[model samples]
Target: MKTEIIWMIIGMGAVTYIPRMLPFVLFRGKELPIFLQGVLKNVPFATLGALIFPGILLIQEDIWYGILGAGAAFLTAYLGANVIVVVLSSIAVLTLYSYFV
Candidate 1:
């Protein structure tokens, strides 16, 4: 059992390390193409979309609630509301939805 656990840890570590290390190692001292750079510049937004899109549409089995919550967040963000305000608004919306729905 101990040996199996050790191997599992080692395997997981390797899997995690390779992806984390590859960009630094591979991109180091290299000038990427302009299109590639543009794409890379948008990587953060793309990643955010990937992380937020799926579950952002489904909260408490009501997809519209999630959409409204996201819209509130976006509006707060656009209006320069601080992080606390944005988060509080989202929580307030969801909480009110829970109680009323």
Candidate 2:
């Protein structure tokens, strides 16, 4: 609602958006090498793993619960499930484990 807040949001969005867009705009006409393309294709999964791995260790009560959730998520993702499905499957597995314990 405030002018300063509006400007800050726009500035923050631009800062994040520009880096993501810059690579595409700069490389639009160029063909990346096969190895480089393969590496780039795995970037999202690597980043997701990096972010999720830490939280996976922080579970209280039992470490096995966290390990089970991680295994389920990994299995679902490896089976070509969408990211949302991977996350939900992890949650479902953990919830059932908790209920049984």
* Clash counts for all predictions: 0, 0
**Which residue pairs in model 1 clash with each other?**
none
TM-score of each candidate structure, all chains considered together: 0.74, 0.62
Question: How do the residues 1-101 of candidate 1 rate in per-residue lDDT, one tens digit apiece?
Answer: 69999999999999999998998988863399888888889899999999888778876577788888998899998999999999999989878877898
In order, candidate lDDTs are: 0.87, 0.88
Model 2 clash pairs?
none
Question: Which residue ranges in model 2 land beyond 4 Å of their true spot?
Answer: 29-45, 59-63, 75-86
Shift of residue 42 alpha carbon in model 2, Å? 5.3
- Candidate 2 Cα deviation (angstroms), residue 65: 3.9
User: Which stretch of 10 consecutive residues in model 2 shows the poorest summed lDDT?
Assistant: 24-33
Number of the top-ranking candidate, with TM-score as the measure: 1
